[model samples]
Target: MTERPADEKDIVLAAQRGEQAAFSELVRRHQRRAYAVARAIVINHEDAEDAVQEAFLHAYRAIDRFLPDQAFGAWLHRIVANAALDVTRRRKVRDADELPETVASPFRDPAEKGELRARLTEALNTLPARQRAVIVLHDVEGYKHAEIGQMLDIPEGTARSDLHYARSQLRQVLGALRQS
Candidate 1:
């Protein structure tokens, strides 16, 4: 008979006791989610990947401090989000000396799917990190405001408001695309 795979709580318990394999299991279970959360905030693939790796390193070191009763995914989510935000902050600092570009799109064909996706990406990149996180978590990932609040350490109302603001911003950007 084959042994059943350990559940998250069991894995956490084992990891807390200095089990390397158990910790690896936790990383395997949550890596995609961690990357998605990081990517949504940082907006650059390499930066997001770096942030997720940093988050996992931090989690591994802090695994002993983890409470078994708490949801590990939620805890990891917070770490990845913070790391991604740090990447964004560092990027902003680096780009501070550059002049902002005000390029209006020159009549791209709306019927082209690639063009639409590119435009959407451009719009998302313009949002503040928190607003981008709110939009991606709530709209793209289908996470509720309460969960987003926990992950981002904000009130649920703030998550909702950020989502509202982000949607409004995207609408304006898309509207400009349509007009152009």
Candidate 2:
């Protein structure tokens, strides 16, 4: 039989058998989305890159135990997201004085677009980490609430509540920005 390109199941099996090449292919397939998810959560490019690297390493180490039926990309995304969250938590605790600043973008019309981006970032920063993660994953990253709940290990109801709360907070922040 001619050797065909391994499907996800084949790759998983090969990875379980300790095939590093198969594992590398898995990483190549999911790396961009994984990094994007990490970047959204961590918000710092360097930190996100580090988190992605750590996540991939963790995934490789843990792949043998991964459920065969689960989508590997989603599984990897969860790992990356968790790693990013850890980075955020550690950074926050390490430097309480180094709170994130909302800087206006220079490329857009300085008067309008800059203010909008700043206000959005401010509102996002105000949310609890879980809520922010849910919002970014669901709204920004285009994951469904169920997928987000699975990735974050939260109940779907909790994810919904977080999304609602995040939306409300952003609205309030935008209103305040308009008033100011």
Candidate 3:
């Protein structure tokens, strides 16, 4: 008889047993969400990609320690968040390569939208790394405070506090931009 398809639990179990193909399957499954998580933190395309790669390698190395009862997506996101923070600290972010025509283009997107995006990005950058992680994980990525705390290895209260402060700071900064 043919074998049944492996479910996520089966995949994790196989991975825990050191099955390389199983781990590869896990990576394939989570890579897009992982990239989104990394991108939200790093705010740069190449750096986010690097973070995802590094996180997967780290996860592969540490997969044996993963508790099967826990949520694998949560566990993986925690690593991805840390990897993005690490990437930011490891080197200065490179400037995007833009052609002069593109840079000088008068046909860019609407001014208000561009300005708002720039302001939001600037505000996010001002936050401390953990605060950024908390806010982005909670707000942008739609993780609960408890899930964020677990991913960040902080108390749930701390995650809530961090998110509050991060949001407050963003509002203050971006609010000022709107008035001026």
The TM-score leader among the candidates is: 1
Per-residue CA lDDT of candidate 3, range 21-122, in tens?
888889989999999888877887898999999999999989999998888998998899889888887744333443345454443344755766776887
lDDT (Cα, tens digit) per residue for candidate 2, span 1-180: 124346887887788889888888888888889888887787678988998999999999999889979888888888888998898998888878775588755454438657677667777887877788888888888989888888877889999999999889888877876666
Kindly give the stretch of ten consecutive residues in candidate 2 with the minimal lDDT sum.
Answer: 104-113
Clash pairs for candidate 3? none
Task: Estimate TM-scores for all models.
Answer: 0.90, 0.85, 0.81
User: What local distance difference test score does each model get?
Assistant: 0.90, 0.83, 0.83
Top model by lDDT, which number? 1
Total clashing residue pairs per candidate? 0, 0, 0
Which wins on TM-score, candidate 2 or candidate 3?
2
lDDT of 3: 0.83
User: What are the runs in model 3 whose C-alpha is more than 4 Å off?
Assistant: 1-6, 92-113
What's the lDDT for residue 41 in model 2?
Answer: 80
**Candidate 1 per-residue lDDT over residues 1-180, each given as its tens digit:** 123256789888888888888888889999999999998888789999999999999999999998989999999999999889888999899899887688765676777778877888999988999999999988988899999999889999999999999999999988986787
